[model samples]
Target: MTWLFNNPSEFAKEMISGFVSANASMVRQVSGGVVRNTASKPDTVAIVIGGGSGHYPAFAGLVGQGLAHGAAMGNLFASPSAQQICSVAKTVNQGAGVLLAFGNYAGDVLHFGLARERLISEGIPCELIAITDDISSASADEIHKRRGVAGDLVVFKTAAAAAEQGATLAEVLAVAQMANQRTRTIGVAFSGCTLPGADHPLFNVPQGRMEFGMGIHGEPGIRELAIPTADELAAMLVDKLLAELPAGISRAKGARAGAILNGLGSVKYEELFVVWHGVARRLQEHGITLVDSQVGEFVTSFDMAGLSLTLFWCNQQLEALWFAPAYSPAFKVGSVIKAPLLATEDIEAPAEESVAAATPESQAVAGQIVIMIERLAEAVIKNADELGRIDAIAGDGDHGIGMERGARAARDRAQRAFQQGAGAGTVLQHAADAWADQAGGTSGAIWGVILNTLGTAIGNQEKPTANAIAQAFSQASHGVMHFGKAKPGDKTLVDVLLPFSEELTLQIEQGHDLAAAWQLAARKAELCARATAQLVPKIGRARPLAARSLGSPDAGAVSLSLILNAVGETFPAVHPQGDTLCL
Candidate 1:
């Protein structure tokens, strides 16, 4: 469905380069996303917004005078790495503060949350606000967990406007939160969206049918029904939104709101206008006044033939901000006078880091660690397609590709660390960083936590002992839980990881050799991972379509079990009956 591309792997990057080239007058390329070339007033809060790339104008296209100071773009449908987020923040931050904003997705939450902490630690005075505007993703009772949809524009606009008015960090955050609380969105799809080079779309709908409450990432819709005419569809959308108005609106009658009739992708402007005509009349019939309406592609899935409607319930402050002047590559309001382009300052490249020192014995075992990582790479590559198939059952279907890319990157980094005479722990730490950097998703962040925790446990100064290995496994389990916020039965990799860690720790405490203990633990992981096939997901993008994920093991759980089994096979010969590990 998405045929025009030179290489799928390079698509997201190349797209960013071209976008920057075309908008050079308005934006300047930064390490993570884009920033306005025009200078900001000193001591003004920086509004940095972003998400995955394919949703163009929603992010980078909105970076200009009266919008985001910068955008932290990520890989296609993947959240940007923490390093990338920090780079963009550092570039955009003036003397006042930095505000990080993005949609409420798992990967975005993890990476952006991490970057915020890091910035705060460095005394950058940063804050974060995740937009949760789509009412269909979560119920009113759990409204905090809703996924952000087209209403992202409303929140971004208000927050950026506050910043443009020289509002302090606290003031900017307050207005952004106000906008988020006031917005509601619902989307429907006639069909699914395809990723570049993918043979099929992310999910499919039956002919002559439409799906309701679909997400921007090609996640399956919450419900499906027979297709309706333009007027019928408009009524359905308005009724759904009106039925659940944000608190404080009291009632829809005589209420004023800013409307956004957003085309996901491949939905033409003419079709959007046709839909809007019916939508406008329906709102008027209800005695609701339209403050303003945005009709076109604002947020999108790659070529998805669908649209969403967003209503921002406005008070006097919100209405005035909505009408404020804005100039961006995608959206514009009142007249925006040209400002002198700021002189771009070159950022100094970070100096190469020196590897940590290791004891002679630990260094000798580094080669074995490299071999283990290579086995993981091989296993992931062999099963990548199947992993993707499993993920496609309920998710965006990129898990297999993400896993393969991460494993290979980890293996290569480990090999290089070993060649440099690094210790086992040092090699694993490098591998962990590479895996997280390359993968750039929820799974990638979890894997990075797992390996980094293990590496910390097995310090380079000493050879690893069975008890030390068991402790590292324990730490890894806790680290994954702490970072991923997934419980054992959440149908995530945590299901396999927790059981495996428990079994391994139990066996080692019973005085078993490391290899034999690991073998038993791997078996437990395999069983647990397989058991996930019967579970319904409680988290991530699959939560809404739990039925679709049924009968298919979670992709993360499967990949974890596979890598554990591979590592187990290599351990029997490498670590013998001794308490101390041997290569």
Candidate 2:
């Protein structure tokens, strides 16, 4: 369990600050994450890597001369926002191009893919490569669907080394992909990891049993068996990893491979070495030459008493790159001379033009919107635990905290925007950005899309009428479906949103009052949200354990319903065609 936290909300920020301070010689603080302190060769491709917090050394600790040029760190167990990724990529760009590398988790895939698009649009060439190296996560034929685990280190290292050699972005991307395809990892856990300030771990293993093929975010393992001796555990890991060889290598006979015995979190270095002894013996028996063996923590799930083994099947080219001289704050290869640290300078984002002036009537509507947002926040906070519990049934248990953070941030930003004489649309837009920036997850990204679409539909020029609100709801639903790529019945917020928006549009077309239409639509959303309890998750991390969520509603769906109902209660009594906006 975690301790010594000043504030649970500020833990990630404080952790980043302390990490940068401790490694001043290796990295400097950037807007989104940390960048290498040493200057790089101009026009060389910059390799930027990242994921959620709790996995140290795998990310920021690898930002140095011979590793990642920069890292985009996010909140614990959450992917970084697209804006955060963009900020770090821009800061690390060296005039030539940038390459984004990360694990193949859904949230990371969505956010990083979006950031790549944004960067490319801005004329800064960028590419993305998601590492899928955990063999246990999927079948050998479905390697692309595998989750990245300890093997992320090998892929990141290869790409960073290629970039350091001044390879073009395409070359670096090819190297990263090659490494990913050649690497395979398998992990087993003795227990689960507890998040900071949480009462219990996200999931737990039975006493005297070990969980096999577990995730780094405290996700339960695929199977469980009675705990074995250290040597037996090591043999199990080695056997599982070696069972599926890379495409080029049919067998491991007379082949060279790089190996890593990684401690998930709480496992001691001494214990890792004990396991490695058995792993090394097995490799030798199998006629596989161990080129470079690493035994310690590389990628980790916080305080999880578990370990993973990664095998990188190396061809001639991969072997050379794998053994190449490299230097980083965490991992290092052969001799590396100390490089001069670059002077620290604040890199501020370009300032936005001021918000447009709002009519007095629109400004009043904006004030009402702020109150509605506050109510949303209050409802979220009140039901945060239940949301988290529902999510924990089949997903990471951070949904409640993430929603709380986004709701509070949205409310705060809406208040500020309203005070600045902004209209309803402008206020919602600001809140949307703030929610995505602070929440930093798939749900956050979807919320940003919903609010931004609604804001755009209800522009600042006029008071929003029932017809306009219905159109905005329709647009919001379409935007979310397009952005999240989640269809109705995916057991996501989209499930609730689609029916609500459709009913809202129908009600408005039937000449209902604004308040009545909204209330009716909200009821539809509530029913849809409750119906999610009978549906299985078809996306995100929960997909693997879809059956486990059979009786629990999607956390996003529940929160959406709660917020919509709260907003409906705040609607004013007014006619659909009245001069005053009813909601």
Candidate 3:
């Protein structure tokens, strides 16, 4: 039930059927399981691209006009056999010769290289261009030997463009090499992907942590770190790529490099834009002019919660060819724009505001609240795995990890603010900022908005009471729902929150005791959370899985209930005064 496939054979057959059916006009299924695009110009140089199937819009989907002439599709994460590669070469050949290009992976190299020998025996000329652009996967001494990631798109397109322009096979091979040499990519995975039909993931990543430089086929990454803000992650990726650029390019071109921000499947476009903003800022800081840029799911690892960054050091020839119009299922030219010009003053903006007129006592309380949030972060980390599992049942299986990781990061800043003795409002604001910076998803962003709103509502309030808390929650709930676009019955965290807020407001208006009011609200939240089982999800990743969730409560709602229960248990003096709390 955890996996989506009936078996490996079925998974592979379904993929092949869907690929050919969807792309029949562009590609034709040939003998020995090869798919050759019908539009490949006979007199033009031939470019053959292939790899495993799961990284769609990659090895196969990209085979079309101004791209690969043919693609050898393999089973999920498994390279195609030499016979399949040969079949594609024979089908696409038109006396122009073939240039074999693919990611620098062992199995692919073996199969493709063997196919090259077969093509030679049949009197067809062949050459190889292996893409090894992932800078994070290897040291400087080993980078050329590392596997390719998202940068393959750049390589395939650059070479294909040259071929389309009537260049001979050798010329196309040279351009492809130039593309690979100028390219570098780095990726981070928030969660591992499952191969089709497999119950368990091909690999495992602990909740709330990220693996940098993970391979497309579920290979382990070079490093594991606490995920940072979209901006921070973007900066980190860009910085590493910049450091690896050819020595003379930055000095000679002086900021004329190009960048591609690619999603490795399952990442939303909005999130990619946020990350791109960070990348643009970081590159600007280094005097590296982003000559051109692209954003989308170019290459993906079947539902992997990750992204990759590719940078290409471009000269006039490459830049001209890069912008030349071409179309494929995954890549498009002319959509890239020249990097924007930013001023030094904008880059060096002040980080702090003047608060000299504020009272010392208020500042001290603010600092204490910051410290409390940091202390609470440890609990978030401890519950990360359980939370991740909960999310997996009805969502992308990342909420638990995302919240835990983000909380832990925010806690670091909170602790520092507390040590400085900041006021409660100041502390809350700091935590909110840090949370957004550390967690780069919808839930984390929502949590940040809530904290920031709570800080504003609590400012200047002398005695915090149940009413004050209720008001703060109500304001926060409004902000979360507004940003997330979830209504109470949408099988979201709002399922628990909406009822809790309404009941708490009612109890406070009646002058009920704080504990008793909270107890009643908690009971209402529990019932609401359970009620989500009868509702279909209408938002986020859960919508597609909602039918299967007919008897299961939304993960977000369940987590909300757990959080409320935990709060009630941890603060017994504030616990409600009835057996209704047992819900």
Candidate 4:
């Protein structure tokens, strides 16, 4: 477990500060991650790459002259906020455009997309590319759905090299996209990771067993298998990547490729080198020539004992770019001329946010909403460990942390808005944005959508009636489905939410008051959530790892039901049995 930390919430910030101080000669501190200590070519394209913080060298360590110009580092196992990305992009961008790239995860996609829009609106040109190179996440026919793993290094380097060559923004984008297309990677984990201040690891691998196709964020693998020897493991990885050669590579014979062997965390250099020896021999046996092969940890998952193999099926152009000189904190390709460091002046201040006052009736309602949110926060924090344990069964084990962090943020934001005399809708609106921005995952984004929808339905003029509340919940369900592309029976939170919405509406129609209706609907949601134990996931990170979760209820579904139950308890409703017919 990651035991050494003071005030876990400030871990990422402190890590960034220390990282900048250590590498001040190369990287400078910025709002999000780091930018080059030295200024870049005046009109050159800026390559900004980022993701969560745990992947050390991948993000901040790559910021330098010949590599990434900047990186937007997020909290541990979470994507950076749009505001963070925007700040990094603005600082690094000169007259030329910015190329924003990151791993292909839901939170990264959402935040990067929003940042791109904001930059464009501010008259700064921006481009985006979500690397999708993990062949295990999706089939070849749907490669776009794949996750970006260790192969991200290849794509980032290729793009950064092109930019260093003074390539136009469009040209840089083209080559980056090409690199992504030609790259394929697969990973296997022997165990899972432990975040700072956590007592136990996110997940565990049985002795003498390995989990194949594991994600970098402590997500359980697609399948678990008995451990194999180094050579056998190498062959398994090589054969898989070779099975689907990139287009234009007719066969392994007479083909040249770039190889990257990445140790996830606990896997040592000796272990990787052993695997690489077998990997090289296998390729040579197949008549494939290795070009500029790299063996080390490029991307990591904290202390997870895992390794990934990335094959960059290269042609003439890609091979040439692969050897480009680069200098950074962790990565170095070849020699490069050093440039003078920029002055360590202060960065720009973050934009200010404010809310306007609302009617007194709506303000009173906002106060109540704050109290309810406080209860939600307390409940989530108390049960965070249990939530994480459930999610580790199949999905990434950060659900507990994300939920706890998001609920606390929502509570704080709602309280601030209430103090500012905001209405109930505006209060929830603030909470929604804070949750999504603070928590940075599928759950965070979906919860944001849910609350925002309810905010829109419940206007600022008056207190919401039972009918209004029921309708708001119904609309919120639709919004969640639309935003997340999840449906009922998918073993996601949607399974609980949809039925809860329907029941709430039914209860109100049956003449039960808001207090009674909410409690009844919460019970229904709890039952629906428990029923998900019999279902297999049909989408999201858990889908590929479905078999491992057969007997476990969906973590998100359970959390949603818990939150509903907690909120329902905030109101008094005395109905032990069904009341006599009101009609």
Q: Global lDDT for candidate 3?
A: 0.70
lDDT digits (tens) for residues 200-243 of candidate 2: 88778889988888878755566899999988888888888777
- When summed lDDT is taken over every stretch of 10 residues in candidate 3, the lowest stretch is 339-348
In candidate 4, what are the lDDT values of residues 471-523, reduced to their tens digit?
A: 99999998778656678988999999999999999988998877788888999
Kindly report which residue pairs in candidate 2 clash with one another. none
Q: What TM-score does each of the candidates earn?
A: 0.94, 0.93, 0.56, 0.86
TM-score for candidate 2: 0.93
> What is the alpha-carbon lDDT of model 1 when measured against the actual structure?
0.87
Candidate 1 or 2, higher TM-score? 1
Worst 10 residues of 4 by lDDT: 574-583
| Global lDDT of each candidate | 0.87, 0.85, 0.70, 0.86
C-alpha root-mean-square deviation, each candidate: 2.2, 2.4, 23.8, 4.3
Return the candidate ranking by lDDT, descending.
Answer: 1, 4, 2, 3
Q: How many clashes show up per model?
A: 0, 0, 12, 0
Following a full C-alpha superposition, what root-mean-square deviation does model 4 have from the true structure? 4.3
lDDT of 1 by residue, 1-583 (tens): 6778889999999999999899998898877778888867679999999888899787899999888889988888888877678888898888789999999998888778778877999999999999999988899999878998899999999998888888999999999999999999999998888899888887788999989988887666668999899999999999999999888999999999989999999889999999999999999999998989989999998888999999999999988887788889998989777878877544324347457989998887777788889988999999999998889888878899999888998999888888888888989888887887778889877887788778878868788887888889889988777766789889999999989989999988887788888989999999999999999999888887788889999999999999998987676354444543463
Leading candidate by TM-score: 1
What is the clash count of model 4? 0
After superposition, which runs of candidate 2 have C-alpha atoms over 4 Å from their true positions?
A: 346-365, 462-468, 576-583
